[model samples]
Target: MAAQLREILLRTRRHLLLARPGEQPSRLAGEGLDFRELREYTLDDDIRHLNWKSMARIRKPLVNRYNESRQISVGLVYLNSGSLAIGAPVSKKDLAVELLTALSYAAARSGERVSTWFLGADECAYYPPGRRQGDLAERNHALATALEAKGEPADSEQLLRELGPRLRRRSVLFLLGDFMKPLDLSALASRHEIHALILRDRLDEELPGGSFLLEDTGSLRRKEAVIDPAAREHYRRLVREQDAALFEHFRRHGIGWEKFGTSQEPIARLAQYLRRP
Candidate 1:
């Protein structure tokens, strides 16, 4: 199963690298020196790009255009929490690693740098951004080791606190975790383009009818509960309410957000998420 997951991740990386065009250049910034064209200047146009000579000859302000020269960078925040181990068939932590591997490889293949931070409550790991595709194996091994290491319970609050100071550049940041707590990401969004990928298990939202024992991975506390209709409905409603609130928060902050089930195809969901405007 591990080998298969790795293969799928590699295939997805190849697909993303070979097919997707380069990121669209921000109209406000361009690094290329090769002038492409000149057009009438708009109010928002940078005065630095204005062709003063052209304006003097034509009696109109014009802006020089050039292709985007700077490469893209992808920042990843991977959560290593005990709750991620609660899932059927495949654990959420394992799936998260697989998806993260795909994203990192794809970014590197596209000539973009990838910076990763693995967060646990007890410890945190940082991997510097690098664009060399040949270093992927070493990077993947380091990431896997970090995720599997036993540590204190990880939470969104800790992640938010630690991530803010580490972002040295304006990059697209992918924050991956099972969001079980409330988050205020408005401030983080101001410095970086943020995308929140929420990992969930169907069992969490819909419990099977039966008596079952549950354990809190973080606290190591066990409890017995009966999944009666009323209990099940209440659980589902709570999950829905939490998710709805989270969605609204992200929307207001201009951060992209999506929830993916542990059983879903990681690559397909990622592609769908990226395809959105």
Candidate 2:
């Protein structure tokens, strides 16, 4: 039953990922293949895909066998930098894990490769892509562990430096966080096409309209802020500025970006972004 739902989700995702028949390959924010493999050259095959090594071994030219070009490989970075350890209905960290998993699974089932990276403040935890059921279980367990752990602080600029050595093929990357600070994103902005999912709970976006002690559940730290006009405006401006900066960065680098709220609209909003050309 769950497998059926996964298929349904994958098909839905594929439908959202529209591509012209045999036109520009789906490598960007679209459903595309995971890897490009080389197979034995066949008649009517494109000579451009010929592998030189297979030529020596089989005494015949080998051709490229791309994993259906209409799939997109996705890499999700579940950021829990102590900042996202806030809010209700669903914890920010848990929400990030769920959404990232949904996105990854959708891509993976659509004949794409999906990976998860847990950026634990200074370092990263990687779950390499695999089709095996056990591998998927390991990925889920790793993500849950990350959701429980705390991130020291994140420097988005320095992240790609560590990530560059790992990823060989181009893949879509998502950085999910509450993004309350000005993160230097120049490095990652260039290396991979990054999409930032700015996560915010009901309190942050909708505003609860009451004075309550803002507390971090993970750390039990508390701060008192008057939920009045001044505080509201202050927060609104700050969020807008950060959002604008992120948007501008993506635009400048030609990186496709989307922001997901912690409310029920996340999947819908993300689905809309995925539907865009």
Candidate 3:
């Protein structure tokens, strides 16, 4: 496990190194006191920084840019639900950990403070923001250990209640999960910049056509089910509806999201998402 994590970190570092200048994965712009330049307003720009006077003069929506700060805070939340343990060849939990490690390493390498929270149904393990080398190493180890352990069902309410109050600063938050549950993140989105990395498996969307026994990973309960053509179609439709609703909610709340299959490499995909202006 240790060697595997080391390899992932090594690959992540190499990937970051290969990225061209100005395309680094860090997207958290600083809000410093020093004024920078004025640029056209983007959807991602904070409305508080909108230059009303400049907009009235130029007749174009513009926002004030501030000099980037030396350091910024990054919060990573891992939704450790049992369903993440389901995947062929490799589990979603493993993929999530890989992505989490990459993001944490990148942030720490850029001299930004990183905080991590592994939240489950009954437990929550939080590591406060730290920029030191030792702190990053410790966080990676803990993240690996948590992913290997059995996960409980996800409790969205508990997650919001616990994580919301602790994040006093307006930071960049990355939410790693399958997100199969109904979620309302308006409060968090309003306070911070949120990016969601949705991890999923092919099997989640399409089930094989046959009769088989199914088990709920969260409850460890078994049931017999027949997956005929009709059943498969129904399941597919439900999944589509669920995803549509999820994406719509994200759009309405101004949350940036990207979906990654468990079979694919997340480092490159994550970098691409972060490169968005």
Candidate 4:
């Protein structure tokens, strides 16, 4: 386990080193006083940064961009729900850990203060913001330990309510979860730059025809069912609808997101997402 963690850390470091100087892990605009540039306003741009004078003169909405602070605050939220434990050969939970580790490591290496929160239905753990290498290691160890324990249903409402207040400073928050339930992150998005890392297994969308016994990880309830062609099609349609609604929600609220499968390497996918303009 330690060796694997080391490998992930090394890989993330290498990726960062090879990345172009202008490519940043998070958005560039922040609370810094130095003016970077003025650009046309986009949906993702914070309304608070809108330059009213410029808009009045140009007859177009524009936002002032400020250089990001030397040490930005980064928040990592791991939704340790039992649903994540359900995956194929590689569980969604394992993939989530890898993504979380890479993000935390990258943030710390870039001189950003990293704060981590591990949240389950009935429990929560937090590691305060720190830039030290030892602090990053401790956060990673705690995250691994939490994932190994039994998982419960995710209380996302409670998470939003509790976590929002704890993060006093404006931050770039990354939420890692299966997100099998409905989500409304409008309030949180308004205050912080939010990104959702959605983890899933291939089986989630495609189920083979067979009689099988399935257990609800959240409730630990067992049920027997047969998957016919019709049933499979119905399930797939529902998944598609769910994903469409999820993406729409992200778009409406101006939140960034990416979907990761258990079979894929998370670090590469994450790097690609971070490099987006």
Position 184, candidate 2: lDDT = 64
Q: What is the TM-score of each candidate against the true structure?
A: 0.78, 0.67, 0.83, 0.82
- Report the candidate with higher TM-score, 2 versus 4: 4
So what's the TM-score on candidate 1? Answer: 0.78
Candidate 4 residue pairs in backbone clash: none
Model 4, 1-277: lDDT tens digits are: 7787888778777665344433455452234478899999887665667899999998999988877655678898888777787776789888887878888777776777888888888878888888786468556755664665345745658877769778898889999888777778888898888999999898878888999998878777999999999999999999899989989999999999999998887788888888676
Alpha carbon lDDT at 109, candidate 4: 69
lDDT of each: 0.72, 0.62, 0.79, 0.78
Clashes of 4: 0
> Compared with the true structure, what per-residue lDDT tens digits does model 3 show for residues 1-277?
6787788778787775344433455474344577889999876666667899999998999988777655678998888887888786688887887888788778877778898888778778888888774458546656655665355645657867878888888888999888877778887898888998898999999989988999887777899988899999999999999999999989998999999887888787887887676
lDDT ranking of the models: 3, 4, 1, 2
Clashing pairs in 3: none
Weakest 10 consecutive residues of candidate 3 by summed lDDT: 17-26
TM-score of 4: 0.82
Once fitted onto the true fold, the runs of candidate 2 whose alpha carbons sit more than 4 angstroms away are 1-73, 133-138, 149-153, 206-211, 216-220
**lDDT score, candidate 4, position 268:** 85
| Each candidate's clash count | 0, 7, 0, 0
**Candidate of highest TM-score:** 3
Query: What is candidate 4's local distance difference test score?
Result: 0.78
